[model samples]
Target chain A: MNTLLDFLRKYNYFFVFILLEAVSFVLLFRFNNYQGSIYLTGANAISAKIGGLYNEGVAFVGLRNRNKELTERNIILEHQNNTLRETLARLGHVETTTEHNVREVLRDFNLIPATVVSNSAERINNYLVIDKGENQGVRPEMGVIGGGGVVGIVYLTGKNHSLVIPVTNRKSSISCRIRGGNYFGSLQWDGKSFLRAYLDDIPRYADVKPGATIETSGYSAVFPPGIFVGRVLSVGNSKDGQSYRLEVQLGTNFSSLRDVEVISTPYKVDIDALLDSAKVKDEADQLNGLGL
Target chain B: MFQTILSRIFWILLLTFLQVVIFNHVHILGYATPLPYIYALLILPSNTPRWLYILIGFCLGLCIDTFTNTPGIAAAATTASGLVVPWFLVAFGPKDLGDDDTLRPNHHTMKWGPFLRYAFCAVTLQCTLFFTIEAFSFFAPLDLLFNILGSIVLTMIFIVILELIRNER
Candidate 1:
């Protein structure tokens, strides 16, 4: 017993070092189950509160740019509204009731405006904090879009704030398709430039060209179809030479991202349920066929 | 002794706040971020207990992790660096120093070359461990190397500047 005490006394530093490191590793690996631990998430109340205060001062410095972007967005929205009205008039399906017009406009999705409180583009997996959260109808898996285009998707939400996994993150993958082409590919970041991402899995035979507009495919319930993603800057072949990889310039300038709109799709829950039931039914049929 | 401990606590908190509020957002060329918070570890007195040194490093890293949302990467890196600091001090620290000596490392104490070397190695170890764990993969070796090298140079610059400011006072 005396010898054991002596050994421990002599090497207590080493033992403590291991103990502390083990604790750190525990926190590290456990963090992989993202959003399960509120204390570790970026949108935790303390961080969000501090970030909110800091961004308020920084946001003031970018007021002019924000104003200009908002003005341009307003003009674009007005043009789109006018075109829709003209098409409706031509079709002789004019709706006089305001409720009908509202329903028609918001038939598929609703946009929840949120301001970015904290954003980082330096890390391999970048995340953002927004002012709106569960109290404001923000939920995980909902798509977020900014003035330029898709910002990211909500990953976690707190009471009054939320964390977003932006497109620049390596884990973020959005299904995108060329404007005129029916072929779709997965858009992913390469952990290099904030403005650039790669769209993979385009077939070799698909006609892809530089400067082509890329937009969402609407195959996922998170985002509706036809939202702009980026423009293709160049095309290259995958490492295996089996498919085409298109270099894309992401539309959203993440460094200056201030305002974003979370796409709240009420029908997503229903669509998810339907898909789950279909999957279960298919599994049961396969089991019955196998006599299991 | 008590007063010194209180002052060290004050500095740690101040450095952490600066790091979280300003330096965390300052990404030069979107690659290099000056992590001066590790400066708090570098400035510890040479006679600081090994166990306390490691504990301080862990707590400091945990504080930053909570704010930055990077839970364990920083803590692990900082703890590892803290564990090795004594060896580094023995190697690059001033010669003829006794075990009981309480000397805060700086350019004046260890001279420019040794202090720079010591700071560079310590900061590099911390940053390398940090970026590697955070990335958790070597898929983009070039980008990872770029990030590590950029952060080392940027952090070294900040550490040297802080040392210089301390000299003035």
Candidate 2:
């Protein structure tokens, strides 16, 4: 008893360190997915205020760039409006109502505007912080897009903030297909450059051309079909001789991302629940088939 | 002693705030996150109790983890750093130093060569441990190596800059 007491007294500090670290590790590994998400809301709110101040100081420097971008956007909108007017005139003979038009517009695409609060480009698994959150209808697995093209998928959501796993992160993989080809593969970041990613699982037999645009296939509930991902920069045969790896230049300049839109799909929950139940039934059927 | 404790606490808080508020947001190169503020925790007085040092280190890292949404990453790294600091101090203890000594490594106190060596080892170990745990089980070996080296270089530069600023002040 005396020997044990002496040993404990001598190494109490080490024991405490081990105890605290073990507790922290358990907390981290167990509740990491959800509790860590809540921290972002408070952090975002505080950082957003600080970012606001920082933006004010640098507003003058960015004015010219912002003006140019707005002007270009105005031109595009004007052109789009003209085309729509022409189409409306052509469809004038058909019975048209305000409700039909509103539905038509809403059916094409829904955009939820969000501001970038924090962004990282220098990590293998980079995440972007956006101001919109669950309250704003931004949920995990929602698609995010910026001015350039497909930005990323929402991974974590807070009360009034969310974190996006951008295409630049190795952890993010988007199901993509070539614009006119039957071949599909996963678009994954190689943690090398912001402008580039790798397309894996593409069969060597498929005719892949450089500059072929890749877009979301709408297979996932997160994004609608035909959302631009990037263009193939280069392609090479893999070591296995069964697959080809294509280097793609991402459409969005993740480094300069400021404003983004979270895509909210109304049918997500219903579809997800149906699919999950189907999976469970399939597993049960498989088990029954294996019974003696 | 009270002033010393108060000042150290103030500096720790200030550095932690700056890390999460300003430096954490700065992503300079596409895989190298600079964490200059960690130096504040690294340079705590050598006489601080081992258990207290480890606890403070854990808290420091936990605070960062909470802010960054990276669970266990900073905590693991900071704990490792705290464990190693005592060894480092004893190994590099100043010759003929008095028991009442409270001297810290700075431009005025320690010679430039020994100070640089000490700072390099401490900062390098911190950065290496941090990157190792953060990239654990998720990244390629080459990627992990690059991240550690890149972060250390950037962090070293930032530390030197801070030292210069402190010297001027």
Candidate 3:
């Protein structure tokens, strides 16, 4: 017993080291997984508070630039509002099939404003913390947009804060297509720069000129189609030569992102149901084909 | 003992403040982010128990991780740094490693010769671990190497400058 006590006492610190490391590893793997990616795990309140305070100080330096961006956005929104008002006036009171009748124009995509607390673009898998979460109706997988354009999707949400996986993350990919072109592909960050990503799987037959506009395809059910993504900087054959990949300049300047909005779509539940049924039907057909 | 504890707490707070407020915003060469806050664990009393090192490291890492939304990557790196810190003290530490509670890893305590080596090894290893964990599961060897090298060089430069200032003071 004496020798055992001595041994334990001598090596207690080493055991503590091992134990701490174990806890850290568990946290690392747990939080990085898809299920653990969203929740009250990493973006705790204390850190969010600190980041919020510091960000408030730094945001002052970019007041002019942010103001300019806001003005430009307001002008564009005013133009859109004018066109929408014209369309509404032309309708001239249609039938009152309101509640159950789903109109093609009523997308139900609402934007909830949020302030970015902490943002980083230098890392391989970058994340941002915003000042809205479950309490504010921000949920996992909801799309986010900043002053420039498409920002990212919510990964985790706390009571008063949420973590965002921006377009710069390695695990992020958005459905995008060239403006006025039928060819669409996945836009993914190469982790080389904050403002650059690549549009992949574009077939060789597609005409992709440098400086062509790329916008979200809206097929993912997350982002509304036709939202601006970026402009094509260059196009070239990928290493395998099977398809063409175009380098795109991202619309959002991630390094300076501050104010953003989370988009919530009410029809998400129906869209999910439709996708599930289609998946089941496809599996059933596959099984029947195998049996025959 | 009370003064020692207070001074130690002050150092920790100051270093964390500098890291969070100033250095966190400074990214160099488009790839390197020097986390001088690792100095939080580096400047402990030489005789401090290895367990305390790990605990302080964990707290410091988690604090920074929360602010950055990085989860446990920083905790893992700093915890590893804490584990190796005592070993470095035993191997290349100053002659007064544990002789006095006030002993620190500065040029005045360990003199210029052993102090630089200690700071260099500790900072380089910490930065390497941090970058590696940050880039975990990604096998892009060239990019990973560039990040590790760039971070280490930048962090070392900062550590040297900090040490010089401390000595002059």
Candidate 4:
């Protein structure tokens, strides 16, 4: 017993090392699936505090540029607001009886503001860290967007912080379609340039012109339809000559993304459940149809 | 002993902050991300027990892992470094090497040829391990190699500058 105790004492540090490593491995592997996003929340809280401090120091340095951006955005919003008002006026005022119905329709989509705490553009699989987590209604598979357009999808959510697998990450692919065309392709980052990505599965017959706009297809629950993704910069036929590969310029300037908005749809859960039930019903129908 | 503990804590915090704030921001060659913070683990006192050194290295790495949200990466790299640091010290023993040799912070005093080789080996091992674990999957081997080489060269340059500053002080 004494010898065993002595042996254990001699290698205690090794035991500690193994224990710590085991803990880290578990965290890494189980991070995304874990229901508790407290770590992300804490990280978001800390990052928000740090970002506040950083903004104070650098605010003056970028004052002119920020003012210009604000003015541009304000003008765009004013135009959109005017257009919307005109459309509403043409339709005439809704009856008081329809007020509740309109409110229910408008509640389908919501935009939650968030701040980017850490942004990486250099790595092959770049990830964006945001200061919004599950506590703030951010969750995995939710779409994120910025000033320009679609940014990425939420990969993992912590309590206060969330990690985004940006459009620039090679591992990320978003289903997108060209404007005014039914043809759709998968947008994938080639892991080379920040401004560019590749569009795959585009058939050769699809009319893809340089400078054509690409937008989200709404096929995925993560993003809504018509969110700007990119513009085609170049097109090349595949080596086998069966399909065309498109090089696209990303809409968002990921290098300078400071603030982002998470899009939450209230109908998402209900829609998903309905679709799942429909699939089961269809499967049951198929079985009955096959039976003699 | 108190001083040693305090310095260890101070250096770990300082190095980790410096890594996140300054070095992580600098992209000298578009791919290079120098990790001089690993030097905090690399330059421990020689007399520290081998097992203790590994434990300290592991903790230092875990601290970094927590901050970066990259689990197990720094821990594995640092543990390997700690295990091999003793051999590196022995292989490159200075003429006047002693217990004080471990305590000295000056990396510039060594002859240029020897210093370069030692720095190369130390930084290379750390970079290789770090990038290997970070890439994890074999799909991006070219990218991993590019990152490792670029980061090692940049880290070596930074280490040399740091050594020069230490010597001047």
Candidate 5:
């Protein structure tokens, strides 16, 4: 016992080093288990507080550019509104039930405006911290869209801040389809460039052109259909040759994303609850059928 | 002793702010990001207690991780680098330095050659460990290599510039 004590006393630093490293690795792996701890992330109150102050300064620096972009958007929106009004006047006598129902479905979603407090794009697993959180009606799995297009999905929500997993991240995958095309595929980041992503499971026979637009398929409850995702840069065969992988130029520039809207759909919560219960029942049914 | 500890804490907080707020947002060529927060761990006084050294490193890393939303990537890499720093000091630092020496590392103390070599090795070790843990997979080995190499070079340039400015002062 005395000799062991002596040994420990002599090499106590080694033990301390190992213990500290073990703690760090534990925190790392535990948090990497996918939304394990929001408090440990940038969305935490303290970090967000500091980030808010820093962002105020940064936001000031880019005010001119932001103004220019907003003006351009305003002009485009005005032109679109005029065209839409003319179309509405033309279709007044022949209003379709499908068009009315689509408008009603869109009304179920509310957009909560939020400012990005902290964001990065260089890392393989990039994250964004936004000012909106649970208190502001933001929730995990809700889609976030910037002025240009789809930004990301809320991964975790703190009280006043939320962590967003941008489309550039490896873990981010969205169901997408070519505009005016029936074929659907999953859009995933290639981990090489923030400007580009890949749409997988597109059959080789599909006429995927370089300039075709890709948008959300609305197959999942996360994002509504027809939201712009990206444009196809090139089409290539998947490694297995069973499907074609189209390289897509992402619509949202993540590096400069400042303002975003979180899609808050009350119907999504109901759908998720229903699906979860169905999953549980399915598991139970399988066990009972197997005599477990 | 109290004053020294307070000053050390202040320096750590300052460096953490610079790293989390400014350097974390920088993505030169969409790849390289300067991580000079490890500069704090690299310049620890020669006589700092080994346990304290490791703790400081871990806390510094954890603080940056928290602000950057990396959780444990920085903490783990910095701790591993801290584990090797003492041995590295003995190997690459000035030969005449004794345990009683509380001198902080600088080019003047260790000479330009040893200081540069030490910074390069330490920065490479930390950057490589960080990117490896971050990627956590061999699927994009090329991307991983570019990130590690780009970060190392960027971090080295920042460290050298910081040292030069300090020398001027």
Candidate 6:
């Protein structure tokens, strides 16, 4: 015991270093595949509160520009809605069947508006904290979309804040496909540019073109189909050359992401159950995969 | 003594705030994000206890990581730097191994040259490890090398400017 005490007295600091590093490595690997621990992530109350106040201050700085962008987006969406409504009226010969619009009929989902309190893009695995959480029905695995397009899925949720696995993260993979093409592939970030990602496992025989619009494939319950993902930038052969790897320009501007709309799927309970089931979970990638 | 601890805590909070609010958002050419929170770790009094240094470094990096959502990556990197600092001091710092408890790494205590060397080594070690851990599961080695080097230079510039200001004060 005395010898142990003496050794500790001499090497306590080294022991502390080792212990702390060990803890860090454990935490690193534990939540590596996904954000597993809420306390360690940005969704924790203290960091979220700080980030919330800070982003609120920053949001004040960009108020006018944000407003302008929203106004422009509103104008475009309104125009598209008008065109869709006219097309509906022309086809069905009824002014409207109900308050439910054509787009709402396509998918029974609600957009839970949320403000981004913290966002990072320079890092390899980036995440964002938004100001809505469990109290506001923000839960893990819900789809999040920004002003431009698809942002990411909500990873964890606190009482009043939630953490998001943003599109810029290396581990972020979303089921997506070319708008008109039947072939599909997963959209994944390559830890480089915030504006770009790679479409994985796209076969070489599939007809892909530069500037082709990519959209969510709706193979999973996280996000509905046809949400704008990005535009194809270039097509190249994968490292093994068995598949076509296409460079894609992501729709959302990750660096400047300020606002997002969390998608609330109507049958979340059913979706979550299916996602959690053993039989379904076995082919989780197929449920989340694009083509293969 | 109480006042010094209080002031150090204050500086840590301030640096953490700056890193979370401003530096995290500032991406230079979409790659380099100057982590100013590292200043808090680098500026701790050189005579600081090894256990305390390691603990504080872990908490400091973990604090920034919590806000950034990288979890243990930051904590591990900063703890590694904390472990190597005293040794680095032994090499480049003034020869006062017996009385290191009071001499801080500030320009006021050590000459600017040794101080800068300490800062460069500590910052390089921390940033290199941080980027390596972040890129371990992904990214090519060449890309990882570029990431480490680019971040080190950027973080060095920020730390130097901060050190200069700390010097003047």
Question: Which model scores highest in DockQ?
Answer: 6
Docking level for model 4: incorrect
Question: DockQ numbers for every candidate?
Answer: 0.24, 0.19, 0.27, 0.15, 0.25, 0.32
Clash count, one per candidate: 0, 2, 1, 8, 0, 0
Q: Could you tell me which 10 consecutive residues in candidate 3 chain A have the lowest summed lDDT?
A: A97-106
Q: Give the alpha carbon lDDT tens digit for every residue of A151-266 in model 6.
A: 99999999999999988887789999888887789988889888899999999899999999888888877778878888999999999999999999988888887757899887
True contacts kept of each: 0.58, 0.44, 0.62, 0.35, 0.58, 0.81
Q: Tell me the tens digit of each residue's lDDT in model 5 across A162-264.
A: 9999999999999999988889999999799989999999987898899998988998888889787779999999999999999999878888887677888
Which is the better candidate, 1 or 6, if ranked by DockQ? 6
Name the runs in model 5 displaced over 4 angstroms.
Answer: A34-292
lDDT for each residue of candidate 2 in B59-169, tens digit (9 for 90 to 100)? 888888888778787787777677777777656657667888865756556666666666677778888888765554443888877777888888888777777776678
Could you give the CAPRI-style class of model 3? acceptable
Q: Write the per-residue lDDT of candidate 4 for residues A83-168, one digit (tens) a residue.
A: 99877764673433222332343356787888889998888989999999999998788888876678999999999999999999
Tens-digit lDDT track for model 2 on A33-146? 543444456468989999999989799889999999999999999999999986775457342242243234336666788888999878788999999998998889998877
TM-score of chain B of 6: 0.90
- Residue B153 shift from truth in candidate 3, angstroms: 1.3
| Candidate 2 local lDDT, residue A68 | 100
Sort by DockQ, best first: what order? Answer: 6, 3, 5, 1, 2, 4
| lDDT, residue B84, candidate 6 | 86
Best by lDDT: 1
Model 4 agreement with the true structure over B16-79: per-residue lDDT tens digits:
8877778878876677789787677555666677787777777777777777767777777777
For all candidates listed, what's the TM-score of chain B alone? 0.95, 0.89, 0.88, 0.85, 0.93, 0.90
User: Candidate 2 at residue B154, lDDT?
Assistant: 82
How do the candidates rank by lDDT, highest first? 1, 5, 6, 3, 2, 4
In the range B1-169, model 5's lDDT, one tens digit per residue, is 7887786787789889999888999898888988888888777877887878788889999999999989888998998888888777778887876667676788998898999889888999999999888877677999889999999999999999878875678
| Every candidate's lDDT | 0.86, 0.78, 0.80, 0.78, 0.85, 0.82
